[model samples]
Target: MEFDISWILMGFPAAFVLGWLASRFDLRQLRRENRSAPKAYFKGLNFLLNEQQDKAIDAFIEAVQNDPDTAELHFALGNLFRRRGEYSRAVRVHEHLLSRADISKPERERAQHALALDFMKAGLLDRAEDALARLEHTPYENEARLSRLAIYERAHDWPQAVQIARLMHSHNQGDYSVRIAHYLCEQALGQQAQGQLDAAKDLLQQAQSEAPHAPRPRIELAHLQHKSGDPVQALGSLMALASVSPSSVPLVAPLMLELVKTDKRKPQVRALLVANYHSSPSLDVMQSLVQLDEFARVENADGPVGRDWYVEHLRHEPSLVAAGRWLAQETLSHEEHHPAVQRALDNAAKPLTRYRCAACGFEARQHFWQCPGCQSWDSYPPRRVEEQ
Candidate 1:
């Protein structure tokens, strides 16, 4: 065959032209698809911006169908579903993302976190807890632990709450010493309820060591001791608390006076109460002083020490509680109507004696270490509502 060099040269340019045309065609097709995807996305965004949730969801669905590998779109859809209270659908979306083998580690963890949130929003606490537990070694560990802590607290699982709180503390999350002490105190209360007095005592001691300046553990321990017929030990605990947590002294003053009477430590306790009263001038401490002085007068035939104390308190501060107390014991000319007048004074003083939570403002006749209203530990100040 004769060599055809002219034909070969002509065929090379023709083939090159064909290849260029095919490449251009393919690029145009790709550009069209890319443009369509963004158009659908923007349609969804417009619908969302217009508060047309149903239309927006439809647009997003179309976009996701067009690009099945869009992880960010899937996440957005899942969150939208969760926000709209469609938790089951949200869980399905996130779980589908998690089950995909092609997802990266970070994406998988994110999917898991999203699924946990879905379960949490749906009120499936057990499933949420399990999902959150799997995120412990991931970047979401701290957030997961905090959520888990909230879950355990809601369930009143003190041991689990304490464990998570300690982990967070070790990780430098925050100062959880006070919370840890509260947990221990809760555990002690549980043990006491179950008739495990010795175990309760040990837990309370551990709580005291955990937060030396916290008032709850010592106060609780004093109550336990008083219940166990060890008034002397109870008084000692109160005395220790007065030194360590002086701000809480008012909360325990009445109990301190009762312990003093029961334990025959009147003189020492009376001195301490008088000193605290002078320093803080709390109504509780004043009432305790009055009781102690009345008892002392009965025991030693001394004249009224507390009547003068109340009158002197009125001199320093114009306290309604102090005035009421002073008036209750005074002899008026209209002594026949004194009972009715005393009833009115007692009624007026009732609200001032309630303890209130600082975080939630929950008032109660008894003091609380944890707020029943907000489930916050140590939210209640160790002061009466009026004092606060």
Candidate 2:
């Protein structure tokens, strides 16, 4: 320990210079990192806009690695993965965002929604349902509920569908009464198929109570009544159908004719059909009238004046179906070849009689409340293809 005050004083400035140099190095490193993150992000965006998804994904992954706390970049990457059908990667990216302690509340909810979508698009409905349930009360609540409704419908979970529909109805999201009615009717059909006749009847009645103006409830209820040895009630339901849903009168015309034949309510049934025909004339109703008139003539040697209503319908609409029916009933000079000619005409008119979906242009021989091809509700118009 000789006197060393000068050496100690020299060491202080050297230490100060070293500390300043170290601080400068740290700032330069931070700047380079900040610049690298943006470069990779912009590169990813450029690739995404060019439809070069694979390169975009690589660039995004690099950016995420460079700056892992970037929630926005993670979200974009997750969506990109989901769009590319890489559900596992998408789920991981979204879940990673969720695990971040620094993420904001809104961002956490957004990541949850993205994760739910990943499950949904991957067809993992059960997982998607649980994920969607967690989004209630958030900004994504209504959209989550809508997706949930669709999922329950596809799963044939009528009770769940009804619950969501009622919730949506109460919130004024959209009028769900008709949708609720259809769900009840679907449940009724399921019960009926399983030999639960009483349960089926109860469900159909509930469906009717839910939507009195809907046609399916009344039409299906009549089928149950007819099966239960109550032709009068069955006929009454159909009569109610004619008044409430005149456009659907054609669908049940043949059923009404059968009831009239069995129950001998010819006068009443004829009047109902006539009134409906005048309101909305259709080939189905017109054919039923001809059947009734032809049967009446054979039974009582008299029938309505418009037995040739087909000939009259042609006067206004030029309906090929009407023409075919009229020709089939007439006698030709070449009577032996008339069967061949009639067969050709009837076969040609069959497609015109089919129902067509207005939304998707899918045609079917039978009417559907929901189009099987497009999965759209009320897509098929009540009128047949020829009329439409």
Candidate 3:
């Protein structure tokens, strides 16, 4: 056999030409497909830039239809739907992405997160809770847990909120001790409402251990003690609070006066209150002093402290509240018109007695642990509006 060297050389060139032509054809087809996707995408982008949301959605729909397998395009479309407040459509797109088996783990997690956000934005809390639970072991775990915590708070599910907070705390997410204490206090309040005094006490004790420096648990515990006819114990807890949180002395002063009156410990309580008042000069402490002195005057008809304390307070601060108190007991020269003048002074001073939230400046007649206006905890100082 000759082995045909010329034929072999001719066959090589023919095969090379065929291969080149095949590659060109494939490249042309790919370029056409690529060009079509970008043209639709740019049209959508242009519509979006022009603030034509309806037209942008139409262009995006066209682009998505042309490139149905593109995860990025689907994500963009889903987010657009969500931003437009079209929750149902956003849910559909994300659900479709989740149904695809070819989606990577990270992409699936992202899609799940997006679906949860859609439910939350649409006020479907039950559905959002389920979706968020599924994200627990994913990379979005922390964010999902935080959202779940917020949901639990809104639902007043304190135990579940505490569990999530503890988990986040163990993972070093942020300091949740104070929040946990608040949950315990809330649970204690619920128990108290149900006439479960012992259980409420136990929860409050736990709350105190959880956040030793927090004022709410101790304050609430004192209230419970006072309710149970144990004003002495209540006084003890309040004294502990004053020792630990000296700035909160004003908050406990009135309670101290009541406890002292009930227990016949006025002299010691008056001394403690007078020292604290001299140091801080709070309106609450001064008011408590007035009460203590008035009680002493009844016990002894000519007590020196009873009628002179308000004058001393006036000397220090020139306070309108102090002046009003002093004027209440004075014998004015125009006795016929004194009642009308006193009524006017009291009306003008009424607003000064309200409590104001430090965070939002929302004023109320009673104190609050959380600001109703801004939903912030520990925002209201334990003082009257005039004191602030």
The per-model lDDT (C-alpha) reads 0.86, 0.90, 0.87
Residue lDDT tens for model 1, 280-346: 7777887887888877664442332766778877777776677788888789998999989888988
Q: Could you tell which candidate, 1 or 2, scores higher by TM-score?
A: 2
Runs of candidate 1 with Cα error greater than 4 angstroms are 1-29, 43-56, 298-304, 329-350
Q: Lowest summed lDDT over 10 consecutive residues: which window, candidate 3?
A: 298-307
Query: Which candidate comes out best when scored by TM-score?
Result: 2
Q: Let me know the TM-score candidate 1 reaches against the reference structure.
A: 0.85
Q: Give the backbone clash total of model 3.
A: 0
**Candidate 1 root-mean-square deviation in Å:** 3.5
> lDDT tens string, model 3, 24-115?
99999999988888898999899889988888888888888888999988998998999999999999999999999999999999999999
Residue 250 alpha-carbon offset, candidate 2, angstroms: 1.3
lDDT (0-100) at residue 93 of candidate 2? 95
Model 1: colliding residue pairs: none
**Model 2, 118-147: lDDT tens per residue?**
999999999999999999999999999999
* Candidate with better lDDT, 1 vs 2: 2
Write out the backbone clash pairs for model 3.
Answer: none
Off by over 4 Å in 2: 1-16, 298-307, 334-340
The residue pairs found clashing in candidate 2 are none
**Leading candidate by lDDT:** 2
